[model samples]
Target: MFGFGIVGLLRTIFRSRSLLWSLAVYELRGRYAATLAGSVWAIVNPLVLIGVFWFVTAYGLKVTFEDGPPYFLMVFCGIVPWIAFSEALSGGTNSVLGAAYLVKKIAFPMEVLPLVPIVSTVIVHAVLIVFLLFIMAVNGLPPQLHYIQILYFSGAMLTFAAALSFVLAPVNVFQRDTAHVIGAILTIWFWVTPVIWPVDNLPDWAYAIIRMNPLFYIVQGYRGVLLYDQPFWFQWPLDLWFWACTLFVLLLGSLLFGRLKPHFADVL
Candidate 1:
């Protein structure tokens, strides 16, 4: 049963690969179509926010982190991936409704629709990673082979976000409030996921609880590669836990999306 479901999911995306890429590119282009800076805004917007956080924590609060990297760098490491996930999930939540014309009027594989925004968001994510590398250079941190784990972690992040979008996109069409609620939830999720703070600062019991969050797995995974210079496999326990939670969400979300897909046009 699980194998068939996995095969179906892969075939859905794979068969629609061309359409997926085209729609994703169009979505990314349309987002900045009217802006003078165009797609460059994608890079600028996050950089500005990172600068604000850097100023507030490093200078305003006189705060510092005790981890391997500098405080601001560590914070930047976590924030970039969080932003990607937030944009993908939040935009994806509304994606079905946003493209209602396609759902209601056209013959389309609705399953792949949610992924369009996610792919678009990943384009911006790739650019943000370049910015991350530049920051590391300025901080006198040379690139290491372990940085390659970023590719692995990024794939994981996208997969998790896609799974979440599958669940959120369908339900969100039925209830418009799901999108707003998701935004609020992501705001809280960010704070709890240790973006601005280090997980090490939490007490043992508190750490165990917070670590249960699926996003925590990706957030810390980014830090593990970028700041800590640790291979992903080095943390065997975390590797086990992260994949377990991710796979659970994947199955749940896929099942939910499949069940709700037929109702999408009616609701939209």
Candidate 2:
């Protein structure tokens, strides 16, 4: 099952490379085509949320820590990847049903549909990273060599999100409630993942459990690279674990997506 799904996944992605880019680009431009704000809305949405988080935590709650980075900077770094993760999973899960027109077309690569949201979210993430860099500099934490490691974490996050969406999109089409369930799960998933709070503040046992969340790996990776100046290789254990889990999800999701795809046209 794993080998078959992985092979199909690689083949679909590679064979449909051009179509994937076209769909992703179209989704980006078409999302805000009629709106006045256009693509800027992507930047604005995350910025506003980040500002609210920063204000509520840094000022209202007076959240502080013994750290090289400021409270606001730390929050922003964590939130940026989260925004990508959330948007990708949320939007990608619905990509297939939303693109039902394409699903009916025999030639369309339905497997690539889940990827559309991942690509769109990455666009926003790139813009958010620029803003994060500026905020970091303003907060006295200049860009470090480790910042390059964001590419590694970001890729991991995109792949993880895409894998989940492949499974979710198919199931979501079968039972519309799957989307709603995912929405609720994300709400709970966010708090437990240690986005706003520091993992180091927790006791050893609690920290170990919380860090088990796959997102904890990506979130901490951002903070590690941007603020802590830690090398990606320094967290080899977690890296090993994250990749192992990612491979499992990718294989399982691919198998599920492939199995359910033939029925999608009828259901949709």
Candidate 3:
């Protein structure tokens, strides 16, 4: 399945290189169309949320950590990955259903649809990371060599999004309820994650749970690089485990999607 997915991805790209870019570009334009700020809203939207959360949590609620950094900045750091994961899941899951016309009528590569949302999301994720860099620098904290873990971590996340997309795409085709269920799951998963709190604040068992959270590794990678200025190290066995698991899950997702795809047309 791994080899098939790779070959499938390559073939899809070769067949619809233009379609891939066209859909991505069109999706971007359609999303921000007729808006006053146009493309600028992409960055502004998340920034606005950051400000709101920062204000409410940092000032309005008076939430603070024992040794934690500023409230907003910490939450913002966590939200970056969360938004990408959330948006990617929502978008990727619905990609096929949303593109019903292309899926039912068109004969081009269908995998690209699931990827469109992920691609769009990853672009914004990149921008968020850049903004985070300046935030760290202004605090007189340049990232350390260990910060490079962000890439490997992000790679794992993209793999997760892709794998989940594979699963949800077919699920969305069969049971529309999957979308609602996924939505609720992400909402709960947000709080379940440490976006609002620190892992250290939790008890040992809870901290262990947090450590096992796949998203936790991604969040830690971000903090390790942007906040701690660290890079990938042999001391970090988490990367090895994350990559191994990510690939396995993606392959499994691909197989499931392939096995289920035949019924998608009939069911949808």
Query: Which candidate number would show the highest TM-score if scored against the true structure?
Result: 2
What are the lDDT scores of the predictions, listed in order? 0.85, 0.88, 0.76
> Candidate 3 lDDT, tens digit per residue, 115-152?
78877887888898778767777877675555656777
**lDDT (Cα, tens digit) per residue for candidate 1, span 1-268:** 6556656877899999999999999888888999998878877898898889889878898776454567888889899999899999988998898998889866688888889988998889998898899889899988887798899888888888888888888888888899999999998999899988877778999998997887888888888888778887766687787787778777877788878888878877
Better of 1 and 2 by lDDT: 2
How many Å off is the CA of 14 in candidate 2? 1.1
Worst 10 residues of 3 by lDDT: 226-235
Off by over 4 Å in 2: none
Q: Judged by lDDT, which candidate is best?
A: 2
Arranged by TM-score, best first: 2, 1, 3
Candidate 2 is scored at a TM of 0.96
Order the candidates by lDDT, highest first. Answer: 2, 1, 3
Clashing pairs in 3: 143-229, 144-229, 145-230, 145-231, 146-230, 146-231, 147-225, 147-230, 147-231
TM-score versus the correct structure, for each prediction: 0.94, 0.96, 0.87
